[model samples]
Target chain A: MAEPARGAYRELVRAQIRSQSQYRASFAMDAALTSCVSVLEILAILVLFRVTPSLGGFSVREAVLIAALCEFAFQIADLAVGNIERIAEYVRTGRMDTVLVRPLSPLGQLLAGDFPLRKAGRVVQGLALYAAALVYAGIDWTPARALLAVTAPVAAGALFAAAFVAGATVAFFWIDSGEFANAFTYGGRTFGTYPQTIYPAWMRVLFGYGFAGYQPALALLGRPDPLGTPAWVAWCTPLAAAAAWVGAVLMWRTGVRHYRSTGS
Target chain B: MPSAAACPRPGPEPESGSDFGSDTRSDTEPDSGSDKNTRSAPDARPAPIPFRDSARAFAALAGAGFRRHSTYRQATVAGVFTNIVFGIMLCAVYVDVAGASGRPGGYTTAQLVSYVWVGQGLLSVVCIWAWKELAERIRSGDVAADLLRPVDPLAAYAAADLGRAGYAVLTRLLAPLAFGLLFYSMYLPQRAVTYPMFAVSVAAATLVSFAGRYLVNLSGFWLLDIRGPISFWMLILGPLCGGYFPLRFLPEWAQWLVWCATPFPSVFQVPLDIAVERTSSGVAAATVLLQIAWAALLFQACARVQRRAVTRLVVQGG
Candidate 1:
């Protein structure tokens, strides 16, 4: 968090961007492909609506609102900290030793390393979906609702970032943990895209609260909880996000302390 | 190293890089094999290998492939866990869709549930994505060793992929399906023939999927850096092959096009339709035949492309 360390992180990101941009055509193609994947995900939701009028008691417009909010949060978090998923590789190849001996914070180095500038494509797509959903959601814009709308995705992104960081800690204990990590990191995003009531009771309690996007989305659209939870739950996203961050930070520190070199 | 254009050899054996100059200068060097006597013209290629030998080789390679996949116990467990999680999430959404509409896409609630679980099981068996072994080999110049082998690289890889699919059936395919059966009301096939037919359809689908991946990998021969194509392929295959949702959700013309003109539907949609018994027996049989046709067409393309790729093969790394 010091000024010099922050400058070092920015320089690390700038180097990655320079190397990535050197191959202009490949970078463009990757960005386009990333954008296409995001489009396909949104299309998957819309296609479900094509067959039925509503999904889990939400009309197509309302579902899109949930999906866009969840997707936007995921993309933001993914762009910010997704590279930590490569910890498994670093540990396997003994590159974690190199990462550890660096002057800056190890987590900061990992976050800044190999930053995927191309993933900005998904962020662009998410924003487009969010903008379109806002127009079609037909919400009455009070001053408070307007403020909540802007901050809601950032809170959800914070929670998702926590999920990614927490997921990366699995690499310290287990090699080849990518699949298990994806089950929650990606799975949690998919869980949040729909109304929480659709999931089984346990799934809703576990992944539903962990995602922390559905509640804010419901509040934004002015829809009552079909499961009849308290209305105050809608305002608890920031609280949930903070709690998740604290837990994730604790887990990450524990994982780093427990890390051992593969010692090839 | 001698230039390949100057030598123009008919077969893949390269004599381990010794005496490169003399080898390229001499054009009349006879091929040292029994098939040389059967050759009528000097420029003619050798006779094809006997069918029994090819089949035995295929079986051995497939066995090796199966064993290789079985070694990854941790990865298998992690993958199974992931598949079951996705299956549960997707099943919840699909149940809502099927329940809302009396029989959306002509599938009952039980049948739709069956479709979802079966599709999850088949996702790994068909292996529509996550196959980059061939491309990596190609990039690393290891594919040159494949050409030196007696068997065709296309058929050899296809057999190995079948073995991998066989392993996937036991772990990746069954675990998630059992999970679905536990929590949901799954539809049982009413007719006995559907079981055998479904098995055959799945095998054909695995072959079709392998051929598709082979073609994608072969692109590395020309493009050198195939990450772009692989990424695009991964993005499209999920939706187009019905991994995310059924292609039946598409319009009628699009469905016809997918089934007839493209090989994507034969990879996942055909086997799924057969498993759910959504189509009648006659139609189910027809879909299996369609899968076979696609597999044959794709493998033929793989063979031709492999032949071409090897002749112009430029190994990237030493």
Candidate 2:
């Protein structure tokens, strides 16, 4: 069962790549533009830090690492489930009916179909920023710390992917819930970039403990929480990410069950 | 007169109506009264070359745009909610940065809160993401009909965008301001003239923004797929326009670069400064003047681009 699903996914991705390759120039231009935009977004934070070296008690370099980590995770998740952003359109246009009839799960098919190679540009940029952050942040690279660095983004990516799925699930009810979901998915990405202590108490609780991107980021950075959370809490990123993903999948299943075809 | 020349294809054989074919066909034939109420047909009668008539036409388009955008009640509500949420988040960030200093980058906590709220409110008003309509029209060749219309396409689109801005101010703007005012210690300008100045500055900034967006969408004529250009514009505009942070916080050299090289500060930052009373009256006046100047320059540029685009379309048999 897994092998067939993996084969199907591979074929879907390959087909998309082949079609996209025909418009190589257009694709390259779009990818370059996206990367430039990502770089500039990082530049905004860097420029801000020029005036004040510290934000929420983290140095500029440390803050950049957090941002880079968030961006890295977001890019990976976006590359995987970015098509979830189009779930509203699918629901409205009755495309969901077509996906529902397939042997594969709608969510899996959507993820496979929308896997974007263009986002590799952003991922590369994230890596560069992450490297710079590591150099400037002056971390002692113990074996455990290095392991945390390697695993943090994957865990963070899983959480972000879960957020995307949850957002898409909302489309089963409200076709225009994209913006509402953005309050979580994009909002979470932005929230994770900053030290969690900077937010209001409610936001810190909602994003840090409830959503779980912040603790993971802090953990990966080997920094204790500015809000004075336990140091051991950082290690819980993978567990938190797994829990969120499971919750999101359950929500998605409920949404699918409730979904009615638009009859287009 | 150009429309006349463009229309005089031999016999009443409809201009090869592949692009915008549905629109022209529906215009010639009466509506079937389907559930989707197609817009009223364009006047087949030739337009007179009078200034008053042009003004009336512009007003009609603007009014239609205002009404059309207001119908998205859900989007408007969601937009307000998003604005409030982000506003609160950013306000907290700015407040935290202020730390014990109580004034990061020369802005008091109250002023920073007000700036975040006002910035969120004016965001849609200034940095419009609605240029997709123009780009889509261009790509679909629907702009052929638009070009053949008597009024200038640039003015028509600009006027319509101004209407959208007006509607946004009514629906999307007030809620964020109210939210910020109720929750945060927002800074209000003390001077009696400050309110009026800010209002005028905002209106001018809207025009500047519209003109810039219109030019960006015009790239669709050349690029065919304008996603790249649009993304590029947003990337450049967001930071320079102070969407992310107040331009005043940037280094002096960066401020100089923005002031001298780009009209971006006029779009969001200047109006924001006026509202926060960061700018002296003299500087506020200068900024407003600069915004108007940019609008005028951009509008002229749009006209030039439209001329070239139309020529290209005509030559290419669009």
Candidate 3:
């Protein structure tokens, strides 16, 4: 994380942005389409609520708050590190060899390679939902609560970013691991978006309710944990995120060491 | 659905269909004698490929596609695992939603559970997305190689896709369904005949799905990139095709319009409804026939477009 290496990463990202922006119309259309997908997903939730008054004891507004938080965190993580999902292709095409020879971190280079700036549309939509959820949930915004609101998504984003890294690591061991990785990465988003009480006990234990952003979301709304976890768990996002990050870094290092090049 | 660019990309125009190579002549049967003459005429239209030739090639290509897909053992396992996970999440949410509302979409809790699981199982079988092979080949100009073969590219690709679908039915479709049955109370068909009818409906649905994807891939001949159309297609078609939930969840008028106006319902809802016996026998038969009609209509469109696209490729010398 030296300054020069950090600048190199910035330059790589800038090059991608410039190339993407050069095609202004396509970029605009991609951004607009990304937003449209965001709207449709939210609509799916709203449509479900139309059929029933509540799901897992949560009203539509409450569920939207959880979903927004999870999606926001997911989008941020996806924007930051999701491109690693392409590791299968990189490995298959022997691009990983080229990446390994570079001075910069392979993970950092892969992330900066195709940054998908257009995903900002979903990020904006997610923030809009969060702001609306804040109003709709009608919480008594204390200073601590206010602080949680700002930091929750960042911490959750770190957690989801870790999930992305950890998921991508599967590719190094097994090249065709994208769908398996999605089982948690996207699956975790689906799990986190709803009240954790609705899931069977095993899912909650397996994916873990905390890293999925549910604990923090519940904390923000001051909702009691139906599974009866302590209130202190709400403040554990940073710690959980750090642990997950350490685990993911170790997993990624192991995967990198395990790599056998697709020798040409 | 429409793009600004409809003309072929600028490239060296092949002066004749002969430029496609010897396969064109070798494959055209002697029985297509008069039709063969027109193909060699200057600025003449290529004759429609004979049906028998296409059918034979279709079977072979489909088998090849099936075998090709079967080789991806790890991917199949991963895909099945992913489907099961989604099935569980959707079933949990849907069961609660259905349980609370007392059959919101006229489906009982059991029926809704069946709907969710079957939808998940069929998600890959029907394949609402994840098809970019043809478009990629088109972009790479590899589709010209397909044209160089004796078989029609449309039939060849569609057959291969059907083969892939066959592989999915054995692995992706059955695994989640077995998982659903293991853990949940699933709906069983009321009548024995429903099974065969449902199978037919699913087959037609696969054809309809293939035709839809084929046309989308064919768009690559004109557009610089097919990503926009592909995304737009998925954005609109995914939910309409019942990958999200049952179309019965839609208001009655909208549901009626979707069934009447689009092929989306034929892809998932029709077969699933038939499988669950949600509709009466008469209505189920009608929907199956409706799916067949859509399949035929879509394949006709595919053939027409494939012809035009091959012509474009020839003229552009791709």
lDDT of 2 by residue, A5-30 (tens): 88998898888777665545557677
lDDT score at residue A219, model 3, on the 0-100 scale:
83
lDDT of each: 0.76, 0.72, 0.75
Docking class of 1: acceptable
lDDT of 1 by residue, B153-238 (tens): 78777877888899999998899889988888899899999999999999999998888888988987876556667667666667
lDDT of 3 by residue, B99-142 (tens): 67878677788887787677777777777763667766676676
Q: Relative to the unseen true structure, what is the C-alpha lDDT of residue B234 in candidate 2, on a scale of 0 to 100?
A: 64
TM-score of chain A for each candidate? 0.96, 0.93, 0.95
What TM-score number comes out for model 2?
A: 0.88
Instruction: Report lDDT (Cα) of residue B314, candidate 2.
Output: 37
DockQ: the better of candidates 2 and 3: 3
Which DockQ-derived CAPRI band holds candidate 2? acceptable
Q: Between the candidate structures 2 and 3, which one is better when assessed by TM-score?
A: 3
In model 3, which runs have C-alpha deviations exceeding 4 angstroms?
A21-27, B1-51, B314-318
- lDDT for residue B202 in candidate 2, whole number 0-100: 88
Off by over 4 Å in 1: A21-24, A209-211, B1-48
Candidate 3 TM-score to native: 0.89
